[model samples]
Target: MSRIKQVFKGNSQAIFNIKEIAKICKIHRNTARRYLEILTLKGFLYETQKGTNRIFRLKTRDLRRDSI
Candidate 1:
């Protein structure tokens, strides 16, 4: 999850799909998706539907806080 947060911190404008997260985190796509989903549920991330893609971004509140 820190890896995902680091990716967001490095690129504030970046939006990640499961596949992209998988590639960046070096995990399976399914695992990436699950993690993202959990983060979303935990109020650390949010999901948006763009066409066929389920893209994710970190919640601004979470970004402003030192801990989530």
Candidate 2:
């Protein structure tokens, strides 16, 4: 219904990796990555890079959705 909500639900997998985001969002890798980067920059999400993989989590612990 809302863009932020969509980003959290249809986009939560991105919280794991951009590859998952692309698959879930049904978009190109670059596009999905852009979404992750944008969200991280906006402070809605934050990323933790471990080796070659990145883990994304929400900045505000207060916000939790069924998808997350």
Candidate 3:
């Protein structure tokens, strides 16, 4: 999880797809997608869909307000 968090720490405003996250974290695409879903549910991240694809961005202040 910290690996995922580290990705956000450097680019809080960046939006990313599962593929991007997977590459950044060096994890499998499915694992990255699952992590994204869990983080979205936990309010640690926000999700936006572009057509058939979903992208994610860090929630900024939400991170401080909520525990992962």
Candidate 4:
């Protein structure tokens, strides 16, 4: 999960879909999606729908406030 967070922190301006995040973190797509969902729920990330894909981006304000 920290690995996933690192990916977002490293590319704060970038938006990512599950597949890209999964590949970057070397985890399964399902795992990436699950982690992303948790982050969204925790207000660390913003989730948006781009057609069939669910895209995620770091919530910059929350990123500065939260450790994770």
Q: lDDT per model, in order?
A: 0.77, 0.62, 0.79, 0.85
Clashing pairs in 3: none
Considering summed lDDT, which 10 consecutive residues are worst modelled in model 3?
59-68
Error of 2 at 37 (Å): 0.8
For model 4, the run of ten residues with the poorest summed lDDT: 59-68
How many residue pairs collide in each prediction? 0, 0, 0, 0
**Candidate 2 lDDT, tens digit per residue, 1-68?**
13444656554444567676566667787776677777777677788775567667656654564432
Clashes of 4: 0
Query: lDDT per residue, candidate 1, 1-68, as tens digits?
Result: 77777777777667889889889988888888787888788787788775568998767743666664
The TM-score leader among the candidates is 4
The total number of steric clashes, by the backbone 3 Å criterion, in model 3 comes to 0
The TM-score measured for candidate 2 stands at 0.63
Best by lDDT: 4
**In model 4, what is the error at residue 16, expressed in angstroms?**
0.2
For candidate 4, give the lDDT of residue 63.
57
**1 versus 2: better TM-score goes to:** 1
lDDT of 3 by residue, 1-68 (tens): 77888788778788898888899899998888888888888778887765557888887654454265
Distance from true location, Cα of 24 in model 3, Å: 0.9
Worst 10 residues of 1 by lDDT: 59-68
Better of 2 and 4 by TM-score: 4
lDDT of 4 by residue, 4-63 (tens): 988987888899999999999999999998899898988788877756698988876445
